[model samples]
Target: PPDVEQLGRATWTFLHTAAAYYPERPTPNQRANMLNLLHSLPTLYPCSHCASHLGDNLKEHPPDVSGKAALSHWLCQRHNDVNERLGKERFDCTKTDERWKDGPSD
Candidate 1:
């Protein structure tokens, strides 16, 4: 099997994910957490569209976590692309979320 560490992080666009089964508003914490994860991150190892890092201008926009919010919807290149492609196009993953299986690092 391929050395899984070669794989990248999860780039989930919570908006579409949430919109699917939940038209209702999300909890404050949930929304905040999503926003933070999407905003603060610096570099993405694996790009959302392909195997590339996130671009600069792409990184400029602050996630839509405004109005005295505590967190932002930060995304690595991969997840950001998905979020943008939605309605126009989309990508699917054959792999499951495997990173969590590994213990935390120092």
Candidate 2:
């Protein structure tokens, strides 16, 4: 069984990568599916505290599934919020593409 931190990292990676590949102009069904996938996380995530916090965040700032860029930016902001709550340094949202989609230039 994965620990909470490991699970969180895996979940975020999956979400960010998925968002990175999401269509620029998704069909209505595609949009609905993506929305469902995201909205289900808070209820289905194994960690109770994480789930509750995500649920509250979702209520405060609903998912923006309009397109890939919008979704990625939204998720980055959400991740930054979680980082702040955990007393971690906030990530630069501007570098989300390099971090998630494109490998950073070494």
Q: What is the C-alpha RMSD of each candidate to the true structure, in Å?
A: 10.5, 1.8
Residues 40-94 of candidate 1 have per-residue lDDT tens digits of 4444334444322334434554554332211122223345464464443433322
TM-score of each model, paired residue for residue: 0.31, 0.94
Tell me how many residue pairs clash in candidate 1. 11
Provide the lDDT at 49 for model 1: 40
Cα lDDT, model 1, residue 94: 22
Which residue pairs overlap in candidate 2's backbone? none
Tell me how candidate 1 scores on lDDT. Answer: 0.37
lDDT of candidate model 2 versus the reference: 0.92
The regions of model 2 sitting more than 4 angstroms off are: 104-106
lDDT of 2 by residue, 15-103 (tens): 99999889999999999999999899889999989999999999999999999999999999999999999999999888888988898
Kindly report which residue stretches of model 1 are placed more than 4 angstroms away from their true locations once superposed. Answer: 1-24, 43-55, 65-106
Mind sharing the TM-score for model 1? 0.31
Task: Please report, as a residue range, the 10-residue window in candidate 2 with the lowest summed lDDT.
Answer: 97-106
What Cα-based lDDT does every candidate model obtain?
0.37, 0.92
After the best TM-score superposition of candidate 2, give how far the Cα of residue 24 lies from its true spot, in angstroms: 1.0
